[model samples]
Target: MLDAGIYEQLSRLVIAMKQKSSQNMAGNRRSVQKGTSAEFSDFREYMPGDDLRRLDWNVYARSERMYIREYFEEKEAVVSVILDTSASMHYGKKSKAELAQDLCAVIAFLTLHHMDRLVLYDSSQMGTPLVVSGGKNALPKVLGWLQARTFSGTETDSFSAVRQMQRRGAGVTVIVSDFLTEAATDPTQDCLEKTMQYLDFTKQRPVLLQTLCAEELRVTMDGTRNLIDMESKEKLRVTMRADVIARYEQELQKLSVRLKKSASAAGGTYILCDSEKERRALILEDLRPLFV
Candidate 1:
């Protein structure tokens, strides 16, 4: 999904996490727990049995108070990329499912390049996800899995699939979906809220990647036509007048605003991307915030 130049730029970047990871394995990213790394953290007063090697002798000479120098520990992080394959994603000019696949590839490359763990999930099934770790050598496996996949699920709930997966070390959780699914009781926004809450509760840093097609954002065709629901296959006939399209756009904007607000309030990042954009632009510009 990415070109050679994009890969070169990505090599210099690591997956950025606002909160430190709790994984104990040796890695490049700093961990929430303190250990012996070159990076320095804040200091505290030295205890009676503290290590003399960590004592700041210079501070002791000036203030006459012994203090211990601490450093942040580096640890590996797990990045879970969940793809929503619902049929609704199959709509649009470029198709949301295709965009989601491209994003998953980029995320996989970044995670592996940085020596972190990677997990791949999809809405098509509820089972074990393809887990890979090591260096960039493992990238082909991820790509192969993505290539063999297709999006045609009618009633699959990707969030439920995520909840069913065995939990791993707390790190980054990137969800790529259209966020269009609605339950009988829970609305679209409410379902997203509950999913974010669960991710937060599991110590995972949430990163929501919302994909939408150009057609969904704007409707230019005005006439009496029939539209079918991709998921339900329910058909409806209506006159697509200017006013009708205008009202639909307004409501869509309100929903977008609410989704953005909900993601921010949950201590996560939300990015809405159009499927028609070039893969290069999406990686270098739109997705830059995801990297450090």
Candidate 2:
């Protein structure tokens, strides 16, 4: 559950969604096509068919050159957030599912505030997505829709989540999940790579936000305990020795490296978040570059 103060805090920032929408409409995101925005993209030599209003009088007067002022085109884009609701997401006291709910809500608000179309997709079902538009006024309904989602599935359908989306123009497609899918056989491949490739094929810019529990990342168990797989309900009773803990940490680190490497190959951004920590910091600090 997000607090009112958090909302106010987020209001200071903006969501940097991928600007790939070919069909342009007025919005905050800078598009490839030139349009009216204060931020200047670059200057192009005046062409015969160029809009006369864009002609730079100062450049013409000073350099005797016909230069046209070009600014980044502001355009509306579809901001589809694919949230994983598998049982593994519910593994911690401050569960990934809980963090995902709040993350999606913030994303929805940012998208709507800037007049971008918003859709929240459930990766667990990989079916209908909740489409929303409007400004801050729509936050309540968006929050309600998000909180209403049930995390019941044993696993996530990452492929279906990306493959099933009806392409809503070139924009950012954010997939938020624990991404705890069993390691790929080759170790060189992961589910995220396949998902990002599908997004690339569909012309949507993909961004992956991988969430893990603090407990999982910083394992501290010291005694023998029954470790249960939330997804399979399979339990294994084993002693938590120093060597076992060391191996687990190594594996987690390897997974992190692989995920980052995969994201680079796919030309997508990979972000890791601890469910117990404040997500706003991640958004405002690490993700601000994309928004620009």
TM-score of each model, in listed order: 0.81, 0.79
Tens digits of per-residue lDDT for model 2, 1-292: 7777767766766665444554234566556776665777667677433458878999999999997775667657778888888888888878888888877877787788777778788876566777776567877888888888888887775655677775666778888887777632236555656766767766676777788888898888899999888888999998999999998888778777876776666666778878878766765665664464
Question: For candidate 1, lDDT tens digit of each residue in 33-63?
Answer: 6776577765777633245887889999999
* C-alpha lDDT (0 to 100) for residue 189 of candidate 1: 40
Deviation from native of the Cα of residue 7 in model 1, angstroms: 1.2
Q: Highest lDDT: which candidate?
A: 1
By TM-score, how accurate is candidate 2?
Answer: 0.79
lDDT against the true structure, per candidate, is: 0.77, 0.73
| True-structure RMSD, every candidate | 10.1, 10.2
* lDDT assessment of candidate 1: 0.77
Give the lDDT of residue 236 in candidate 1: 91
Off by over 4 Å in 2: 24-26, 30-74, 183-190, 279-283, 286-290
Each candidate's clash count: 0, 2
